[model samples]
Target: MVITVVYGVLAVICLGYFAGIVIYTQTVGFALFWLLTGLLLCAAGAYCAYRRKHPDRLEMPLMLKSAVFTCVSVGFLILAAAGITIFMDTEEEAPEDLDYLIVLGSKTVGREPSDTLKLRLDAALEYLQENKKTRVILSGGKGSGEDWTEAQVMYLYLKNAGVQTHRMVMETQSTDTEENVIYSLNLVKKTDTVGIVTNDFHLCRAQALARKQGKTEVYGIPAKSNWFLLPNQTVRECFALLIEKFMGNI
Candidate 1:
């Protein structure tokens, strides 16, 4: 009875969360994951209830049940551990003095920076305004529906924010975070103290990749993430961190 109640409640909460994201962000791919898992849990709960009400209908081996339970338990534990690691890096302060700032790219609508990109740009602008000596490396490639490369968009945005052209460098060939680190780091010398500018939820993986790419002294200048998208993105970041680890990308 307790198990049924827990599963049923989780399923409802999951579905409600999914609806919340879709309604708020109009985004789909990232939001589908938790919703699907919740529905699966709902099915599982239904099966458990059926087994209880109609014991003779189907008999499950105790070992199979134990295995399923163990897998779910272990999965939650792993996610919790990853969440902890991610949260520890979320509010990292950008060092007062820095040689280089890496403003990582995000989606752009036509030539305009997307909301996420805007937050990064704003954060980078604030940092640059305060740290006059810091040079910036704008990283990202052109994606569909984008009128210009991500680097180009960031370059213009920063330029408009009063960042001098000479203080900024553009690395336009990279399309992903690993490439962002690889290509951007090349533009800056090894001795430079690098700081990555991105949303707070993304700092952990971004720093990890920077470290993996041999920039061990790199730091994160985390920008504010949109509150409406925060829950889904935070959860997504856990899976992303795990994958990056498995692939040795970070």
Candidate 2:
């Protein structure tokens, strides 16, 4: 009876979790994975409830139970580790004197910048307004769905926002973070100090990648992450960080 009640409660929680992730996030991989796992939990709960009513039925095999427990424990550990990385922050507060600022790109819809990209640009704009001597590098290639290259869009947006054309350098050939750093570095002198401007959730890995590329004197300039998309983005970044770790990119 106790096991049945516990499973029933878990089923409710799992279903609720699925609804929240699917409806709120609308993110592809994360939402779908959560929803499917939730449905499986719901089914398992239903089976448990049925078995409680018929105690003669066999329980879940011990090996399967152990596997489930192990998977859950490992998942929790990974999540906890990723959560700790959020606070392993670098020098996020914009400095008054930077020789170069590399503003990383986000997705662009048609010709308009995504909200994520806009926030990074807004941060750069503020820094540029205060530090006129700092040259800017807008880094991103044209993604498949984008109408314009992210770098071009950022360059044009900042130009209209009062940053001088000569102060901006567009790096449109690189498609990923490694290339973003590598190509942007090529445009500047090795002796030059750089400020990495990216979303707050991305700062830890971005700085790690910079250091991997031998950029020793880099400062992180974090932009505000979108509140609605924060959960999805942070979860996705955790997976990305894992890949970067395995690839030895960070």
Candidate 3:
């Protein structure tokens, strides 16, 4: 009875932690993590119940118990399949050519680009350098902590990097990714084909949203995130994908 009670308590804690991850994180990776942890707790609860019914079976020895645990662990393999499905369904492929390059915004630390934002900016610069004829649109709004809008910061960054001001369009009123596409699209001519630049994990949703907003020819140019940040970011993106799917927002 004591063992059962202990396992029950631990199981509840594990479930609560999983719930917290879902509520706080936006990525698909968190969902996969919680799903695996929940399955483990469930298995532990089942094991406790089974032991209670056959206490004398303990004589079967530790080796047999280890084997049972190993077999039970295979359930997590299903989670991998689910994760892959979620990821693949959201990914948007890039087109061979584009007329406009749209750069999405990341968080700014007081008017300056944060490291993550810098990576995005740098990627956009590289793309612009490669495609000299493409017009660039920088989209972002001024948040509470920002000294200036994200578009303004990006404009300055690109200009300092030697991109001519005439080739850049600044959309400075969008506060989120969806808004970024919507607001920036207004600035693009109807005949133009757009290429969106954002973090690699975000490309899938960003492209989907852009298409929904009436972009006939859209492409994605993905920027890589740092290794340590990937887990959290991926988890957040999974949730974003799910929400977009549920609401038909993508």
Candidate 4:
């Protein structure tokens, strides 16, 4: 009964988080993960209730139990590895006087930066202010329902923030992280010491993607994430890291 109640509470929390994310972000994205997890928790709770009423109603075959255990074990291991990787570089600092700093783009609202993207931009702005010689590549294409290319939005934000036009280079054609690295790298030599700016939860994957594309001196400059969204975003990044590994992207 205790375990059953715990599962019920967990299910409600997950489902409520999912609904809150949808309402706040106006997009589903990986909030589906929360929805699915909530449903599975509910099912598990139901099973526990049934087992309480029928203690010996059914027993699983040993072989089938072994298979299920193996699957669960493997899944847990994968998720753990991905979570570790997602967080490994969250506190990294880029070496000074980098040849280029790549600001990977996220969503923008109309002509303004999204909260996530603004964090990246602010981080980049701070770094660029201190390291005036480093040019920045604002990388991202127009995503669905956005008012302009993400790169363009970033460009205008930094410009108004006092970063000169010559200091900003726009790679406005890449739609995702891999493409962000690929297209941004094309604007400079692979041997260049580059820094990638992104939210803290995304630093590892962004740095890994740069290294995968033959960058030898790349590093990360992590921006703070929105506290309320950090858990959801980090869990989503773990899945993304696994997929990127499966697709040979990082």
Among the numbered candidates, top lDDT falls to: 4
Candidate 4 lDDT tens digits, 65-120: 89977998999898888888787857866778899999999999999999999999
lDDT of 1 by residue, 79-129 (tens): 889888987956767688799999999888778898889999999999999
lDDT of each: 0.88, 0.83, 0.77, 0.91
For model 3, what is the error of residue 201's alpha carbon versus the real structure, in angstroms, after optimal superposition?
0.5
Global CA lDDT computed for model 1: 0.88
lDDT for 92 (candidate 1): 60
Model 4 TM-score, all chains together = 0.93
TM-scores of all models? 0.90, 0.86, 0.67, 0.93
| Candidate 2 residue-pair clash tally | 0
Q: Score candidate 2 by TM-score against the native.
A: 0.86
lDDT of 2 by residue, 1-250 (tens): 6766676676676567657755654435465555566677767777877887887786878899999999999987996698679647644575677999999988887777888999999989999999989999999999877889999999989998999999999999989888888899889888998999998888888888888888988999888888866766777788788889988898
**lDDT of prediction 4:** 0.91
How would the candidate models be sorted by lDDT, starting from the highest? 4, 1, 2, 3
**Pairs in steric clash, model 1:** none
Alpha-carbon shift of residue 229 in model 4 (angstroms): 1.2
Whole-structure CA lDDT of model 3:
0.77
Clashing pairs in 2: none
